[model samples]
Target: MDMSTEDDEDEIESAEEEKEEEKESVEAESEVIDETIILADYMRRFETRRMQELAAKKEKAEEKKKQLRYLIGVEEKRKRDVSVETIITPEDELTVSDRVSTESLVHPCLREIDISESQLKILNPYTVYRVPDDPGLSPAFWLLRERPPIYGTDGVQKFYDMVKRAGIRSIASLKDLLITDQIDLRYYGLESQVMRAICEALMDNTYVRKVDLKDNKLSADACKHLNNLLLRNSMIINLSLSGCQIGASGAEKLYNAISTNATLKTLDLSNCNIGNEGFEYIASALSNNQGLESIDLSNNNLDESCAENLRNLLSYNETLTHLNLFWNSLYSAKTWKTLIKGFEKNETLRSLNLSWNGLGVECLPYLSQLLSRSRSIDKLDLSCNRFTEKDAIRIAKALSTNNTLQELYLGNNPVKAEGALALVHAITPHVSPDNVLHLLDLENVWANKDILHELEAIKMLKPEVKVKLRGILSNYQLVGPDIKKILLKRANYEAMAPKIKRRKRNFGHFVMSLSDKMISQEKFMALIKKFKLKLSKSLINEIMLAFEGPRGTVDQGQLKSFYVKEFSEATVN
Candidate 1:
C-alpha cells in the first residue's frame, strides 16, 4: 500500500511540470505577437509620412513652373508691344533739352525754329526709341540715315542747321578734294568757298567735336578760317588732314593754332605733302604743346634733314604715344641711329610705324638694340622693308632676351626658312618664361615644312603666340575622296569647264589640244576653273603647281594617278 501511494505522488508532480512548460511557451508567443503588431504599425506610419512629404514637394514644383511660364508669357507680350511703331505728332516731338534730359535721340529745339517760316516741313524727327535708357538707342540712331554715311554714325542732318546757316551746302560736299601746296589757293574757288563756310559754321557749333577733312583741298583762306575756327571751338579733339596738299605754310598755320589749342588729341597729316620744313615747323610748334597724343606723319616727304627735329620733338614731348613715320625717306642708318637715341630718352612713345621706309641690313643693328632695351615700344611695324636672313637672325637674337615687344610685323620681307626657324627657336618655351611676344606677323616670309612644323609645335606649346604664315592655304591638308568627287561631278563640269570653240565636248578636249597631251603651266590655271573644285583659287593653284613636270608642263598621267594613290594609301593606313 505505501509503494502505490509514492508512485501516485510522482505521477502528479510530473503532470504539473508538463503543464508549467506549456504555460511559459504560450506567454512567450503572445509577447512576440504584441511586439510584431507594434513594429508593423510604426512602419506603416513612417511610409505614410514619406509619401505625404513627396506629394507636397511635387505640388510646390508644379506651382513654381506655372509662375515661371506666366512671367515668360508676360515678358514676351511686352516685347511684342514695344516693337510696334507708332506715328508721332509734332507736339509729341521732343526738344533738345528734353531729349538730353530723357536720354532720347537728339533733336533740334523746335521752339527756336519757326516751323511756318522755315521752307522745310517739320517732319517727325526720326525718334528711334521711346525708352529713357534703351541700349539699342545708338543702333536706332545709326539706322535713320537720310544722307550718305559720314565718318561715324553721326548723321548729316545733325550739322544741317549750322552748315546751312553759314551759307554752305551740307558739310558732306567738302569730303574728297586735294588741297594744293600753292600759296595762292583762291583759284580752287569751290573747295576754298566750301571749306571757309564749313569752318565758319564749326565756329558756333558745339556738338561737332571730331572733324575729319581727310583728302580735301583747303586754300590759304580756308586755312585761315580753319585756324580761327580752331581758336574759337575748344571741343574739336580729333582732326585729320591726311592726303591733303597742305604745304609748309599750311602746316605752319595749322600747327601754330595747335600750339595754343588745348583740345586736339589726334592729328593725322599722313600723305600731306609736308616736307622737312613742314615737319620742322610742326616739331617746333608741338615741342612745347601738351594736348596731342598721336601724330601720323606717314607718307610725308621727310628725309634725314628732319631727323634732328624729330629727335628733339621725341625727347621733349611727353604726351605723344604713337608716331607713324611709315613710307617716309628716313631710311639712312645714321638717321635711324639718331632716332634710336631719342627713343631711349622718351619712355612714353609706345607704337612706331617705320614700314615701307626701306630700312635694310644697315639699320637692323640699331633697331635690334631698340628692341633689346626699350621698355615703351610694344608695337613695331617693319613691313615692306628690306630685311634679309642675317637681319632676321639679329632681330631674333634681340627677341630672345626682350619681353616687352607684344607685336612685331616683319611681313613683305625675304626672311627665308632659316630665319623663320631661328625666330621659332628664340621664342621656344624652354628659352624664357618672361617672353611676352604674342604676335609675330611674318605675313610674306617663306617657310618650308620643317620650319612650319616647328612653328606649329611652338603654337601648340604656347597657345597665346600667333605666327601668321605666308600663304593662306599653304598648310592645308587635302582629302583624296573629296578631290575625286569634286573632279567626277560630271553634270556640273559642263558649266565649270566650258566646251572648246567649234567643239561640243567638255574640257577634256581642251586638255587634249595641248602639245604632247601635256598642259602647260598657263593652261593648268584654266584647269582650276575647269575642275569646278569648291576650293580657294590659291589652294587650287597650289595643288596644280605640285603636278608640274620638269619641262614646266603638268604631267597628265601623274595628275590622274594622284587621287588613286592617295586613296589607296589612305585605305592602307
Candidate 2:
C-alpha cells in the first residue's frame, strides 16, 4: 500500500488503542456495583473523579503558565539590572530592583486600597462593598454580612433611589460593580424598581455576569426589574432564580425579558414551581431566543401538557442545547411515545435527561427506535428505569443500526443475566470501530462473572466499546441478564419447599469450590465432606442438567440463585 494509506491505518490503530486504554483505566478505577443503588449516585462518583482529574490537569497547566511568566519576569528584571549597572549609581540600581519586584508581575489583578478610614470594610482591595451603614443612605436596600460585608436582597426601590440620589460615592464605587464576577443577594425579597436599579448598575459596569437571587421569593414584582436588567445589560449571562417561587406571571415577564436579551446563556429557574402556563410562556420565548444555551427546569411539577410545550420548544430552538427535565412525570405510555417523534425531529438538542420518569421496558423502544433514526443526540441517559430483558433487546437492536450515540448510561435497571446475554449477542455484530456506543455504562445492572466473560470473549469483534459491568453486592460476580438461561432454571424450584428439597438439593457452595464447573464423580464425595455440606449425587446431576451452559459449567450466579430458591430463607446451623 501507499504511504498515505499506511499513515491512515496507523492513525486508526492509534485511536483504537486510546479507546482501549480509557476503558482499562475506567475498569481499574471504578468499583461500582450494588444493583439497588441509584444511577445518579453511581454517575456522581464517575463525575466527581472526572472533575477532580480535570481540576488537577487545569491546576498543573496554570502552574506551568505561572512559572513561565515568573521566568520571563526574572529575565526582564536581569536585563534592567544590567542596564542600570551601566547607566546609574548603586543607589539607583537598588531602587530599580525594589520597584521592579517579581511580586508585581505575579498577579496583575491585585490592587492596593489607598482610601481613608471613612471607606467601608470590603473583603479585599479588588472587591466593592455595598455597606448598609452609610450615613447618607436613604432606606438603603442592602443587609451587610460580616467578613467583607457582601450585600444580600433588601429592596429594589432603595437600590434605585440609592443610585438616583447623587453623591453616593459620586457613582465612583459603581465602577467596581462593573467588573465583579459574582453578585449574590439570596433571600432579600427586594421588590419595586429592582430591574431599573440593576439596569443602572449594568449601564456602565460590564463584568457583573452572575446575579444569584435564590430563595428571595422573587415574583412578578421583581421581574420588571429583571426584564430591565436583560434589556439594558448584555454582560449578565448566568442567572439563577432558583427557589424564588416565581409564579406563572413572573415567568411570563421573565420569558418576555429573555426573548429581548441575547446575552443570556445558562438560565436556571429550577424549583420555581412554574406550571404549564409558565412553561408555555418560556417555550414561546425560547422558540425565538437564540443565545440561551442551557436551561434547568427541574422539579416544576410538570406533566404531559408541559412536556408537549417543551417538545414544541425543542422542535425549533437551535441555540438551546442542554435541557434538564429531571424529577418530572412528563411521561404516560402514549404521551412519552408521542414525544419520541419530537426527539427524533429535533437536531439541535445534544443532552436529553428523562431520568426518574418510570419509563418502563415498553417505553424504551420508542427512545431506542428514535436513536436509530435521529442524527443529533450523542449522550442518552435512561438510568433509574425498570428495564426488562425485552428493553435490553430493543436498545441492542437500536445500537446495531444507530451511529450518533457515543455514551449510553443504563444503570439501576433490572437487566439481569438473560437480558445482558441477549444484549451482548445483539451488540456483538455491531461492536466495531465506528460503533455508536463508546461508553456502555451498565454498572449495577446485576451482571455476574459469566455474563462479563461472554462480553469479554467478544472483544475480537470490537474492543472500542467499553462495557462497565459489576454490582457492589455481587462479591465480584458478573451481573447481566441470563440470556443463556443457565441461572434461571432453579427459579422453578422455589415452589418446592425447603423441607422437601433439603436432602435433594445440590451443595452449591461445595460444587463452587471444586473446580468451578459441573462436579465430576471423582471429587464429589471428598469435596462434599471437606465443605461439610449435604449433597446427593442425583441433586448434582439434576442441577447440571438444568443449568449447565455449553462448557458443562453452571453459571455461578445461577448456582447461587438456585441455592436461594431451594432454600428460600434457610440458614445453616
Candidate 3:
C-alpha cells in the first residue's frame, strides 16, 4: 500500500507541472491580442486625420477656381469697348502754354488749316488741344490768339469776308496769315496749292524759323519757290525735304540756299533720289559752308566717285558733326581707306554711319587700324558686312587697345566659333568686374556650340562679362551620339589615362605574342587597316584581347582567323 501511494504522489506532481505550462501559454496569447487591438485603433485615427486634410485641400481648390473666374470676367469686359483710332494723336495738334498770345506764337504752329472758321468755332478748344476739361488749355493758346489768324478751308471764305468787312488793305494782310502747320489736303488733291501756300507763308513771315515738308509731293518748281523763300528768310534753322522727288537740279538749288543760309543748322534730304552730280554739288556746298551741323543724305545714289568727293569735303570741313551716308553703293576697300584717312584728322565729326555698304573681310583690318588712331570717333557701324572669323579676331584685338570706341556693330557678320572664342578671351580679361563690356553680337555664327562651351567657361572664371548670342538657331543641330562617345573615349585614353599601366600592358602583350610566334609587319599593318584604328596610342581593348588566356582546343590559326573576321566586320559596319 505504501509503494502504491508514492507512485500516485509522483504522478500528481507531474500533472500539476503540465497544467502550469499550459496556463502560461494562454496568458501570453491574450496579452498579444490586446496589443493588436490598440494598434488597430491608432491606425483608424491616422486614416481619419488624413481624410480631414484631404477635405480641406478640396475646399481651397474650389476657392481658387472662383477667384480665377472673377478675374477672367473682368479681363473680358476690358476688351469690349477698345478703339484703335483713340490710341494715337497727331503731332501738330499739341498745344503750348496758355500765356502766349496767338500773334506772338510761331507761324510753324499751324499744322492743319482745312477746318472752316464756323467749324473751328463749333469744335471745343479742349478737344482740339487734347487738354483735360479740369485744367483747360495751356497758356500757349493765348500766344496763338495774339498771333495772326490761321486760315483753313473750313473758314477761309468767312475769313476773307471778315477781312473785307474789316477793310484790310492788300493781299499782304492775307500773306502774313498763319496757316495750320499740319496740313492734310489729300482730300482735295490740292498738293500744288498747299506748296504755294507754304512758300507764300514762309516768304511773308519773318519769324518762321523751321519748315518740315516731309511726305509731300512738292515739285521741282515748288522747290525753287521754297528756295526763294529761304533766300528771303534768315531765321529758319531746320529744313526737312524727305520723301520728295527732288532730282539733281532741285538738290543743287537747295545746296545753293544752304551755302548762303547761315542760321540753318540741320537738313534732311533723305530718300531724295539725288544723283552723283547732286552729291558733288552738295559736297562743294559743305566745303564752303561752316554753319551746317547735321546732314542726312541717306538713300541717295552716291557712288564711289561721289563718296570720294564727300571724303575730301569732310577732311576740310570742321563744323559738320553728324553725317549719314547709309544705303549708298560706295563699297570699294580703297575708297573706304581713303575715307578713313580723311576721318583721322577730323576731330569735330563725332557720329558717322556707313551701314549697308557691302563691306567684306578685306575692309576690317584697315578700319581697325584706323580706329586705333581715331580718338574722336565714339560710334562706328560695320553691320551687315560679310566678315569672317579671322576678321572678327583682328577687330577684337584692335578693340582691346582702342579706348575711345564706345559702340560697335557687328550684328550680321558670320563670326564662327573661333572668332567668338577669341573675342571672349580678349574682352574678358581687360574688363572691370563692375563695368564689363556692354555689347557683343555673335548672331548667326555656324559653329556656336563650341563658342557656348567657351562662354560657359568664361562665366565660371569671370562672371561679370555680358555676352549676347542672337539670331535664328532653330536649325542648330546637335552632334550624333556615336561620334560623341568615340570622341570621349579618345579624350580619356589619350589625355587622362594612366600612362605607366598602359605602357606595361602594351609591352607585356607585345612580348608574349612575339614569344609565342613571329608576327609579321604585314600582318600588323593588315590588322590596323582592318579595324580602321590609329595605332599611335595603345587601346585598352587591344591589350585586353591580346593578353587573354587561350581557350580549350582553339588553335593559333583559328584564333587569328576569328580576330581577322571580327576586325573586318567592325570596320565595315
Candidate 4:
C-alpha cells in the first residue's frame, strides 16, 4: 500500500515539473515576439524620419535655388500685388494726393463713353463654374438634379414647352433661363417657322438679354415677326440675324423696331446680302440710335456711296465705338476723304478695322491728316492695303504726332526699308519706359536688313515697342555680318556713325598705303591674304588705272572705283 501510494505521488510530481517547463518555454517565446515587434516599430519610425529629412532637405535646396535666381537678376514666377506698370511716381509729379487711393476708374462719377468689348479688356473678371455630370455629386446639389435631357429645348423655349406639356404653368421657370450665349434653334425646323415660335415666346420673357439667329437663312418676310418681339423685349442687349436673307425692306422693318429702343447694345446684320438700300436704312437707324455700342455690317454689297452715307451718319450721330465694315474697300477718293473727315471729327470711336481695303498711297495723306486730328484710335487694322514706302513714311510721321493710337497693323503691304526706318525713327522717341505703343505688326511687309536693323535699334532704345518683323518677304536682301552694323546708342549717334564709316573707309586707305609702299605682286598677295579678296587680272589692271583719283582710293567715290565696290547704299547696286 505504501509503495503504490509513493508511485502515484511521483507521477503527480513529474506532471507538475513538465507543466512548469512548458510554461517557461511559452514565456521565453513571448519575450522574443515582443522584442521582434518593438524592433520592427523602431525600424519603421527610422525610415519615416529619414524620408521626412530628405523631403526637408529638398525643400531647402529649392529655396536656395530661388534665392540664387533672384540674386542673379533672373525673372522668376511669383505673385505680384500690383501690376508691373504701376510704379512709385514722385510726390512732386502727382498733382493729387501722394497716398495710395482706392478709387476705381469705372465709377459712376466719370463720363460713360461707350467703349466696345474688344477695346475694353475685362481682365480676370470672368468665372468658371464646373458642373458635375452626376447630379447628386454636383456643387449645387439642391438646385440641380439629373433628369432625362429633352430633345430640343434651350433654357427658355424647350423648358417652357416641356413645363406647359406637363400641365404645370409656373412663372418662376423663366428666371433660370436668363443668361445664355445662344438659343440654338438652327436645323431643328425651318428658320421662318421656328423663329416665329421663338420670337413670339420671347415676347413673354422678362429679360432675354441676347439672341443669336446666325445662319438661319430665313426669308425677308420672317423679320416682320421680330418687330413685335424687339418692341416688347425691352431688356434685349444684342440681336444677331447673320446669314439670314433679309433685304432692304426687312432691314427697314428691323431698324424701325429698335430705332428708339435704348436698351439695345449690339446689332449684327452681317452676310445677309444687304445692298446699298439696306446700308442706308441701317445708317439711318444709327442716326437716331442712342444705346448701340457695336454694329457689324460685314459682307454687304455697299459701295463708296454707302461709305458716303456712313460718313454722314458718323458726322451727325454719336454713341458708336465699334463699327465692323469688313470685306469692303474705299472705292473712291471722295468716299475715303469723307471717311477721313468723319474720323477726324469723331471722338467716341476707338477701333476701326479696314481690312482688304485697296486704300493706296493716295489715301495715306488723308489718313495722316486724320491721325493729326483729335482721333482716339487704339486699334487700327490697315491690312492688305498695298502700302508703299512713301505711304508708310507718311503714316509714321502721323503716328509720331498721335498719342492715342496704340496698336497699328500694316501687314501684307509692300512697305520697304525706307518706310520701316521712317516709322521706327518717328515712333522710337515717343515710346518711353512707362507709356508704350502696345504693338506694331509689320508681318509680310518687305523688311530687308536695313529695316530689321532700324527696328532692332528702336527696340534697343525703347524695349517696350513690340515690333513684329516676321514673314518671308519678296526679293529682300540681308546685310552680311561683315558689313557696317546699326547705330543703337543714340547718345553717341553723331559720334558713332562717322566712326563706323571711318573704320570701313580705312579698308580702302590701308590698301592704298600697301600699294604705295610695296611692289604690285607683294601688295596684291598681302591684300588677297588679309581681306580674302578675289581680284581678276583684268580687275587689277582696272584698279591700277582707277587708283590715283583726285581724292585718293579711300575717298567715298574713289574707293568704289578702285578696290571696294561699296561703302554705302549709294555705292551698292
Error of 3 at 293 (Å): 2.3
Q: Say which prediction, candidate 3 or candidate 4, comes out ahead on TM-score.
A: 4
- Which clashing pairs does model 4 show? none
lDDT digits (tens) for residues 386-489 of candidate 3: 77788888877777776665566666677666676676666654442322345555555544454665566657766754666563234367766553235324
Which segments of model 3 are wrong by more than 4 Å?
A: 1-193, 204-210, 429-437, 441-467, 471-573
Number of the top-ranking candidate, with TM-score as the measure: 1
RMSD of 4: 33.2
TM-score of each: 0.52, 0.50, 0.47, 0.51
- Residue-level lDDT for 236 in candidate 1: 75
Query: Which pairs clash inside model 1?
Result: 177-217, 179-217
Those runs of model 2 whose alpha carbons end farther than 4 Å from true positions after fitting are 1-178, 186-196, 421-433, 454-465, 470-573
Instruction: Flag regions of model 4 displaced more than 4 Å.
Output: 1-181, 185-190, 430-436, 471-573
Alpha-carbon local distance difference test for all models: 0.70, 0.65, 0.61, 0.64
The root-mean-square deviation over C-alpha atoms between each candidate and the true structure, in angstroms, is: 37.7, 43.1, 43.3, 33.2
How many pairs collide in each candidate, listed in order? 2, 25, 33, 0
lDDT of 2 at 446: 65
Model 1 residue 275 lDDT score: 95
